[model samples]
Target: MSNLSDIIEGFIKELLEANSQRAIEIQRNILAQQFDCSPSQINYVLTTRFGNDKGYMVESRRGGGGYIRILKVSTSIEEELKNFLNESIGDSVTLNKALDLISALRERKIITDREQRIMQSILGDRALKGVVYEDRNKIRADVLKEMILASAENDM
Candidate 1:
């Protein structure tokens, strides 16, 4: 059986595909009624799946007219590449943090599976193992940034 989060994500994806510009107005009462789940469950899905790092912006209005609005942030391939390059610069990203950032990009459909795999390989601890780990990491970051920037430029 699929989990509630997966189901909700699929539903939201379908809705987005059908109308890319449309903002979903989720009401706890209405979603709970449809899914036969608690209102809090609805909240959980929104909080976890519709986060900014995942390229979604969520807003809610309270009271009788209370509704949740989820807006998908659409960025060009160039924009995403640029952002990734900018972030990777001048920083020593830990393995866990790097994974998290990659996961977020994957969730937003900005990076392909192959790209992610390559990125992992390049950023893996094994690749940076040595007395010069810090230097290796900095070099890796620079290389990754250059790759992204080059890809972005190609897309233009």
Candidate 2:
């Protein structure tokens, strides 16, 4: 069975899908009531699953009129790639973050399944095991950025 966090993430993704604009405003309390979970649980799912690194931006207003707004940040392949390179990847990225970024690329059909697997293999922790702990993330970021650029070049 899926965990509560997974379930809530799915529900929110469904709502986002139903909206033509690919964005949604939701009430934390109402969603918490519906899920029978605390508002903090909802916040956990939103931050971990829908964060900027995962290609979504979350904004929340706290109060009686407060609401949470989730926005799908990328509109086009170019824009998405740019965001990943210029913003998401940054100077250093953990292996998990790199994998998530690769997953986002695959989700958008920016890369094929085979390509995704290949990229994952290249960026996986095992591949970087020999590197110094402090330098691994930095090297990973540089490599992934180049790979993304190469893929974009091929598409052109």
Candidate 3:
């Protein structure tokens, strides 16, 4: 059985997929009622899943007539790649950001399904066993850079 958090996440994901522009408040009460959970439970899901780093922007209001607005920031994989290349990709990028970037690339068709699987396998925590977090991040960045460079060269 799915946990409450997972259930809530799935519900919110469905809502976003069905109507990306729908305000969060529109479904809050209904979702709470359906899940038999408190309003704050909904809030917790929103904060954790719809965070800025996850490429979602959430705005909410409190009190009567208040609303919660959720926006999916559509970002290009090429733009994200450029950002990753230019920014100080610290010793270990958070797992969430790395996954988000990979997902974006897959969505944009920048990476083939096979390549994604390979990359995932190589960068997986198990593969990085014995390495410290910081070192693992550095290794991941190096590997990612190499892959991106090869992909670019192939495209050229």
Candidate 4:
């Protein structure tokens, strides 16, 4: 058996896979019991492992009869990559937002973990040293656009 968090993640993924729509709903209390963990543990897995960057949408209710719903969005990675180029990112992007884009690509399975790390290394502040803030952001934007385009091309 794997770690508790991994086991819980696997179980939820199994349920999602077994369904036709790639979605699933469950009571947090029930899931916690099944995993022999606290309800918070279940929440931790859901938030960190199944974040938006991970290509999941989560909804939940607070009280009794409340349920947690996980929906796997059907989106094209290339489209999102383009959107970033055309909209989200301006001439420059903040480090945090840049990393978010990378994480989203990884979550979408458009890029591998190695790719994410490589992008971060090449686009991080250190790589833009001596450049003014404005120019650095512009450089970051260009680099990210090129990388995303290359990745999208490879996918096609």
lDDT of each: 0.71, 0.89, 0.69, 0.83
For TM-score, the strongest prediction is 2
Per-residue alpha-carbon lDDT of candidate 4 for residues 10-81, written as tens digits (9 for 90 to 100): 899889889998889899999999888999999999987786656678999989899999998776766666
When summed lDDT is taken over every stretch of 10 residues in candidate 1, the lowest stretch is 146-155
lDDT of 2 by residue, 1-156 (tens): 999999999999999989999899999999999999999999999989998767788999999999999998766777777877988899998898889889988877788899899999998878888998899999999999998888778775
Sorted on lDDT, best first, the list reads 2, 4, 1, 3
TM-score of 3: 0.65
| Cα deviation of 138, candidate 2, in Å | 1.6
lDDT of 1 by residue, 78-153 (tens): 6756665565444556666566666776666656788778777877778777638657656666656665555346
Poorly placed runs, candidate 1 (over 4 Å): 82-97, 104-109, 129-147
Q: What value of lDDT does candidate 2 attain over all alpha carbons?
A: 0.89
- Model 4, position 121: C-alpha lDDT score: 93
RMSD of 2: 1.6
For residue 155, model 4's alpha carbon misses the true position, in angstroms, by 4.4
TM-scores, each model vs. reference: 0.69, 0.90, 0.65, 0.68
Query: Can you give the lDDT of residue 38 in candidate 2?
Result: 98
State in Å the error of residue 39, model 2.
Answer: 0.3
